[model samples]
Target: MSERLSSRSLPVEWAPKVDPRELSIGIVHLGLGAFHRAHQAVFTEHAAAITGESRWGISGVSQRSASVREQLAPQDGLYSVLTRGLDSPSVQVIGSMREVLTAPEDPAAVVARIADPAVTLVTLTVTEKGYRAVAGGGLDLADPEIQADLAGRPPRTVVGQLAAGLVRRAETGAGPLTILSCDNLVANGPFLRRLMEDYAAALVSVPEARVEAVSSRQRLAEQLESTRFPAGMVDRIVPATTDADREEAARLLGVRDEALVVAEPFIQWVIEDDFAGARPAWERAGAVLTDDVAPWEQAKLRMLNATHSMLAYLGGLRGYETIAEAVRDAELAELAGELMTRDVVPTLTPPDGLDLTAYGASVLERFANPALKHRTAQVAMDGSVKLPVRLLGTVRDRLEAGAEPRVASLAVAGWMVYVAAGRDVNGRELPLDDPQAARLREAAASAGPGPAGLVDAMLSIESVFDKELAADKLFRSLLIEGVGSLQSH
Candidate 1:
């Protein structure tokens, strides 16, 4: 074997799509993780390669941790995306990432990067929790990081950091910025904008003008108004890299790759074309630039994501390790389909040139890709935060249309049972690793020992279920029945 994967070690054939040394950082990306490296970074590289443009290089910031920064820094910000299809996996080195920054280590540097005039665009994939919204859809004022940022800390939280950066932009007269959120949150653009507004509004209450916040409240609001937060829908299954995966990557490359990320063959990004400043021509790289990303977002959130979570909870409870193994089980496979067709499909307005039937089939096929090795317990995490965006909308729609959301309720029930049981059928520990795990488990434990009891107890959680949904006799009955049936397994 050769030395580790660096700009120096790559074979001629495996040279990055774009030359790393020549490219300059024009995009400051928050949440430098597997998904961003596999999805957007690759697309940006492709877009640059096809257009012969090199200004859209990325400055990746690892927010929660410095591990990703550590992984890629020695490699000259280089990494290989191992695309695992049905047959053999394909390895490609990505070069668009020019610089890596750890947000916590140098929060001011992150704000400076965002404020840099050369960096016209900022993107985020910091997951749902990164948004840090209260259940009622505003910035979580109680979050300590937010409080710290408002109290004149260096802005550690994502929202705090973004607010600081935008305020910096306003001060510097850096032209309008396009803040594209590449997470799976519903109406992500508008949601993020609202969070920013909440943050900016909260800054006003700080008796003294916070140094990290805007000195002029109206000026910061105007800067926010000028900025564009475009909603984007991204799809790809990037699994946690294991030693086996690293070994395989080494075998393929004749060199060890520390920052190797693996993914399924399928990858798609549908972006809303509402940028406030110049941006990458992502369409050149096979991204869909559309006027309305809502339909696509809705379809993905409800159909694929909701179904994926359903399979995860159900499959984890049934003792399956990976999603492929779970979907391969005939009964679990059938349940996934029913959730898609019977419950989710009827509620969606399929985007132009999309076939709900074919999309459903393809999603199932993607889920069944064994090479990806997407874990059931991993997807099963953060169910309380995920359920509203992924499943509850369908439940609400079906109920509004005067129909029973049977399979959807079953999906919700799967989560409930998974949380309560905390183990698979074979006595393997299926971790209840949710942001709201403590509260949810407390509710589960306090409930009287039965399906109805669990249902009644969880329904009382206003964060997950509103007054109307919790009050619905049909929903309660379905959940109780669903929970009861799953517990019998």
Candidate 2:
């Protein structure tokens, strides 16, 4: 066997007798990252294992660069998922992926794979920023990459790739496809549908359309209209694997696994049952298939995701290295609990059968998993985009109800202090790695001194805050006080 982990190097007992080479790629995943590898891919593999299906193979597309491709290509798309629960660590070899493609390196190959008649479902987990949508909503047509794709170049963005592939599928009369979004957005499926519609509208409105362009635009719109964009809720604590994790995995398997992903033992996927065609028997593998995934999506987003961001910002500002450590701080933990119990829970009508109290407790327990080593910095990155998705909804709801979201405001205040001061309480440099970092930093610096001007400045940013939210007297007062307290810390 080679030094690296591959089919030959993997423990034969960990897999079914089915050979990897015989499977066909039926699903094309847009973002080939740790979460999808640990969550959806694992579910797909287990589903196929139960049914002995060979056509449920995954062809993962690393949208940004070739790093993931480089890691998995040599290993026959086999990677070990190191589940870091509270107990001892365990490793398992997964063979759900048949191949990994770098979209940037070969965009045409990606489109062609998606166009395959055999493929019926396309899943995405490209994070919030990947959508390239504007601050409020809709596609950012002015984006250079989106503009380039519109100019007949290879589609580079996630939407562009899907658009091009859908056009091809429509032109070739490929059967209906399901485009499921596993991201943390609200009503992910319908939200994705809106994004696609926006893209299709942009394409259809391309001025002075040539005969060929007109044909392509019409086909793109038709295909997207027919495609299923089912909303989904995915939950798992997939931490970025570190050298220590790889070392432990190598020791466990007796072979180096370069493409390792670390995750918690707990995983839950709530998918709306609206696929256009056949899909994996994911329900057989513990996924909840319901007529309404909204309840589940809301519960996860407002409760779990909102708390995750709060811990990230407040914890990162406190100089904690990992989420586990951050949550270990007694005061921060209380605030996080309050944010869920006192604030976020009120805004959510939890999906049926989900006890919001127990769910919130379980969420904190998951966040406190010491073995997972979920970094505060990693979670805290891209706050400018993350804030709206995670925290602001509850803030909005609370504001409308004439209630003061004191704890929620503190979380937002933590973010401002984290960004404005650019250092932990210990004076360690806190990295402000946001898409709107320059403008945010400028807002902080330009707003004179003290928390009053700083809070006003941060709230004034159009991309991150709704004008109404910024103008609210209660929200402003709370933010100023929260910022002042955090600064004093």
Candidate 3:
């Protein structure tokens, strides 16, 4: 065969792949990253292929990065995805996207696309921290970004931006649109809609004092009628793209394609039964559409995400770089598996007819996938933002049921040590990434010799975990032991 064609110049064989001119951006995805490309885009591509509907093509939008735009814009948004595994590797040109819009390049244009009637679904993979969760996915109306978007000037943040675009579309009678949140948070859709509507109302409301006067409980219960935030459960381990990914893409395509996304061979999308506007036939392409995504969400959050966090903080502190490496440590891996099967899984009410044991086994296998070098730092970042749902939620749930939460406490303890800001077992510096990282370090520094002091800081931060849990004796004691083990080790 001849040398590979330049990614900048499409080959005749690939021109029929994804005709950008023939596609109107029907889906607007925020946070254009590897997960989105490997998971959502690939699903949409398959859906369109089955139905022969070019309108399912996507218009990717990125708020901060221009690199994806530069690379994808040249190739007409047709990039290749390589799914590498221990035994096999598969390559395919994913054609779900029609173009990309980097917000910095033209904010107005990006907003206009969201407002477009042709765009019926707005998907996101902005991660757990990016959602800015407050009290069980409750709306954080005090957020300045929400305030700004409500004022109708412009949005500085993701929630604000989505609200702004939705308001514009709503005003234009663009009909109903589905806001698909693909983050790891439990009840991801409702979490997103809460913020979107809360922000939009702040824009039209009278005063901040009056808005606050309306209690969040009443506000949330009232807004359930008109909104369509479809909760989803997503799985797949696509690590942050390293320099090697870019080099490999260049070599494979015979030209530099900056936007190439690399991932493992696994993907999944389980969504709740709600969609208002036009939507792609994602079910035709293997996506699960059901009346409830709660069980799946709960299962994934408590098992996959919670276990990952445990490994992340502990492994990062122990000087393990990647999750695979961390799990390879006999003790840590065994501890992780034990925490899941014993503590986390037992607390959860598994979906009807689902085998919890099988699920837990699968989670362990995925974590041990050697090909996906999911870094501990990447998972460990933003503890304050992630802990509420990823860790504390499960702990709080089990506690509410009056069940023993020893393993959960250990996870919390791991978080405590991880946040202390120091070297791990190997003496390599552990660079903390929480929003309150500095404050946490300062507190741990001034804390007493026991883990009680460390646990106190984490629970006391009303911004991070539930305040009621702070006063519990068992919670504090377990965390203390957890801290003592690592600190002493």
Candidate 4:
């Protein structure tokens, strides 16, 4: 029988701290996936260790299922993060998470924990769809989950759950708290705040609802005023853990750990310095706390994420499965460099001291890390939700400046072909894992298998393109040309 990873078996030399018995849950994190475990939880563990702030333990809630709880609870929320490098792997046992709760099983418990006065900071990594936010930074009440939430039903979405939690907090006289959004969207904090405000306002205005369960308009307004939503930029390449990774962890730790997370050696978190209450000493763990995170946010989104999407689409079309495999192609590497320098750079104004050129080069180097096995299909999963912030902003800026965004247009065209065919050039059935996949597929099918018609149909998508971009003759022509090149390839 294999040994199990727990407090009893964890080696002392691995720098483990805050035994599970002594940890006090002070932060509540939603979406307890691999990325959160590898990135935020690791940082929190280090912060607690450095400052002896054992109270900052995380109560991780898995939004959809009980899988994470099953993996972690038996281990007492202890897991090893394998930092895979080209030469060797470094392993650290993370102990910042004290409890795991599955939302579908016990959402009320999750809300109560969030409402608890001790829980001053709530962080989320639920992807952009979790926000259910519209273009102008307000809750999309039209969403079925949001509509159900508005009807005073049991909360379903993250926005509904957070709003419900805040209402309970106000009712119980819990003080202010901070909500940190660790997703990749630009200005994520303010954006989430707007959605929360909109959700709360809807609750206050609904007459048939339980008046006492929901906060009054004025009370909700005060809560909104007191609460802080700080935007954050988090970067770490954490591939989905494989069975081989689990076996490796078992060999290294002398125990079989179901909750093992694997990631690259590089990790960075740039968070806005605004907070409503006590926070972890994250800066001690190499996180950058800044008054403004906009520049960094923009840099990562356009420079890293945009190029990542570009490569995912184009690379998959060329039968490359992993990011490293794609970037290894000399032609694709040169295309990435050109896209970053010529297209993405002009659209960005880097912060006072940040060198855009060097940063872009480093980003490419990180992508080329062969150890991580970052799958192109994984990055390509949510194109519809990602494109606006990642690639479309640069497209708009370039067009406004009278410069044709050739590389950016190619990325968009690549996506258009990708969604249309639903299969890579290698005949592998691609996973169309986007929220808007159905509509996108329908639009492509309606265009009838030709690149020109499909490009036209995709460019007309209002959600991805604004009216000006959809109507610009020059932009549409470049997109057509780009799609033609992909077809010819």
Candidate 5:
């Protein structure tokens, strides 16, 4: 414990007193990180506070990062959440997490808990690259980890872990459990299900005799469709933690917390209603529940994430650190504003009663938050993994509708320049995180000849830009312009 600095009358735990151990772990969250704490945990806490149902409390699971557990579990699964605005910050202690399970510590136990009947739902916030989808809703069978988990006869990756758990739940006659995917990936629920099912099917893809034995034991593999998968759209500008954030969190919480998460004041979760058995009062907690989340997904993918990629690539090349820092540049900021309001929003139909202009304004404001130190390097990671859906998909959609793709073309140019970077405008080494970085770098080094060969090869990867798009006259013309910009800049 440390000295208490605040004289405010509020208790250290401002949230209502509710023993989470008394409640079963109805929700198991994967990739327990800052976003989960600031978004889903806060929502769950509010739901629990109002409904007094602790069963919705979360059992957080982490395989790679045990540091979050180190910070959160010490306070008896308690941690402070700060929502930052322009002037002041609002603080609250979230207590909806019942326990933090380190899967690496006890994989079997994690599997068993997921199999438990009391856990009715599983939510995942694993980053987009973690999905390991090859392309077009199919599994990346080439992934060594996925292959290992299939061979090892237990779960290794998140999808594999989840499939094993689901099988266990089915064997014991546990009722249907909803698998809610809260990541920004398009059609997240169906995408997750396909990945999971692919992993499960790979288990029995061996010889006939071996396949028969495995199938007999893991009969629940075929019953995956019965398990609900709800697509969702989550919005918040929670930046990566820095030394300053760590120190500030320790000062406020009266103890050092490595897993402390700082976020902006705004948050939104719009989910498609598809719970199997029971769920928390998400609607009561201000979540927008609808029969269809597609329109909302489209808007977010095109407007928010699309613009984010633009800032990320361009900002990195220009040596900007955070989104706020980049947006502070008048030229870049205006470009982003125009992209959202003009090219992107035209294609999207905002949900009923939701104002697109107001939403766009709010998004810009959030992007300019000085408090959130979201790094360009962080956002710039896995670009080879993100380009197709985040940029080209939207561009293709617009082209199919016979609309102009000026902003989209600009973003694509930014990516090309970003990938070819040896140094930023500040002479800082640009850390490009793409599978084809080396190839791109080599191609860029030999830019004496036409760069079209490099562009053609990159576009042919099937994972990023599709073959059909590569053949389009307008698309190729845009790429030519984009490539010219890259060489000049």
Candidate 6:
């Protein structure tokens, strides 16, 4: 056993700016994962340090498992964020988290934390699937867990847990709160608010006999109305932490840290300045609080996220394991630039005074940072959920403008080929980590071994492509050609 990370053992040079003992839990964060630790918690700590506020400490809840709690509790929620730059690595001890709880072990404890009047803000990074969104942007009420949640059973999903907690808060008069979404989804704030509201309504609209014995429908509605859901955009390439990363942290601090997180030395957070109550002075900590986040959101989604997906599929097919290796390839690098300049840029109305060109270049540079080993497989996960927002929008806009979405078409084709083969070009097994993986594989297998048939079958997925695009002759031809090109390579 090694020494644990705590205030007593913290090195002098890496000490937290604000004394951890003075901080109080004022924020409740869901999905206690690497991204949250590297992004939001870091910002919150800075916000408190800048404002001399000791009330912004966070109580983190792991939605699915107890692993995070087990790692951080013994250390008193102290973790090191290793920023991997091109030249050298820098480490910072994050002290924003004051408590850790796992939903599976004690959901009531998580709910109780949320109901605490001192915790005025709630933030989430539960990803796309956690929202349980359907095609038309509504809750997937048909999902088994969602159905059980609506019927007032103990909540199992993120949205379900949120609904249950907020309802409890309402009944207990815990006051108004703000909910901020830090996910990659387009218009994430409003999207999450709708999902939560819909879930609450479903709970109340249940048959009278099935309604839970807690609060009335009207009370829940009133409490929800008081809650605020602010949309925000967060950008950082924080990879899943490996055992090697933990060992490195232990070497640096002379103490073992199981909750270590590794990230590239770049971070950007743009949030809509819409909050119901007090918030951290994150602006002082390098966050941009704007009245309108749409332009920035669109820019990041189209340029950065879409290009990332392209690299994951196309680069993975070319036998690259990591993003750094993939982006260094001349052909793939040029293709990424083309995708942004030609197809993606046209679809974006970037925020005023923003340079889309420079942003695109910087994104490529970040992808090529050799210090960060971001796996292509990690970025490629949940393709079925990510494609419509990241790439398809560009394709749709370019088609409407009478211009060919050549690169976007190729990206779609790359995804199709990847899903069909289920293995990289190097003969490595590629895990299809997607909700629609089974359906996609069956479709590909049924279409026979030819690229043309596979292209037709993939394009026909109604959940992924709009009916018009699926049936478009030009789109179909371009996709077929793209698929054939991949097969030849």
Each prediction's whole-model lDDT (CA):
0.89, 0.88, 0.75, 0.87, 0.77, 0.87
Model 1 residue 452 CA deviation in Å: 1.2
- TM per candidate comes to 0.98, 0.98, 0.90, 0.97, 0.92, 0.96
Q: Single out the weakest 10-residue window by summed lDDT for candidate 2.
A: 10-19
lDDT of 4 at 144: 86
Model 6 Cα lDDT, one tens digit per residue, 1-489 = 578887777778878878888999999999888999999999999989989999999999898888998888887788999888897687889888899988878877887888898989999998877788887578988899888767766676888777777777887888888999999988998898888878766765677455452354566677888888888999999988888787778888888888899999899999999888888999999999998889999999999999999999998888788889999999999999999999999888889878999999999999999878888899899999999989988888998999999999999999998898888878998778998888888888888567779988887788888788888887888899999999888
Record all residue pairs in model 3 with backbone atoms less than 3 Å apart, i.e. clashing: 150-203, 176-277
Q: What is the lDDT of residue 224 in candidate 1?
A: 95
The C-alpha RMSD of each candidate to the native structure, in angstroms, is 1.3, 1.4, 3.9, 1.5, 3.0, 1.6
In model 2, residue pairs whose N, Cα or C atoms come closer than 3 Å (at least 3 residues apart or on different chains), thus clashing, are 189-231
The regions of model 1 sitting more than 4 angstroms off are 210-216
Question: What would you estimate as the lDDT of candidate 1?
Answer: 0.89
How many residue pairs clash per model? 0, 1, 2, 0, 0, 0
Q: Report lDDT (Cα) of residue 241, candidate 5.
A: 69
Off by over 4 Å in 3: 1-18, 205-227, 250-252
lDDT of 6: 0.87
Query: Candidate 6 at residue 401, lDDT?
Result: 94
Per-residue alpha-carbon lDDT of model 5 for 1-489, expressed as tens digits? 443222232254554355545666788888888889989988888887778886887889886768877776556677767666787665676667778888777777778878889988889988777777886768888888777666655565788778778877777888788999988788999888888777767777644457553863366565586788889999888877677776776665555555567888888899999888899998888999999898888887778788888998888888898888998989889888888887888778788877888877877788888888788887777777677767777787789999878778888878777776657888998787776577666655655445565466556556666678878878767776766766676
Model 4, 18-40: lDDT tens digits are 56577798999998889999999
At residue 426, give the lDDT of candidate 2.
Answer: 84
- Assess candidate 3 and give its TM-score to the true structure: 0.90
Off by over 4 Å in 6: 211-215
Ranking by TM-score: 1, 2, 4, 6, 5, 3
Residue pairs of candidate 6 with colliding backbone atoms = none
Model 4 CA lDDT for position 448: 48
Ranking by lDDT: 1, 2, 6, 4, 5, 3
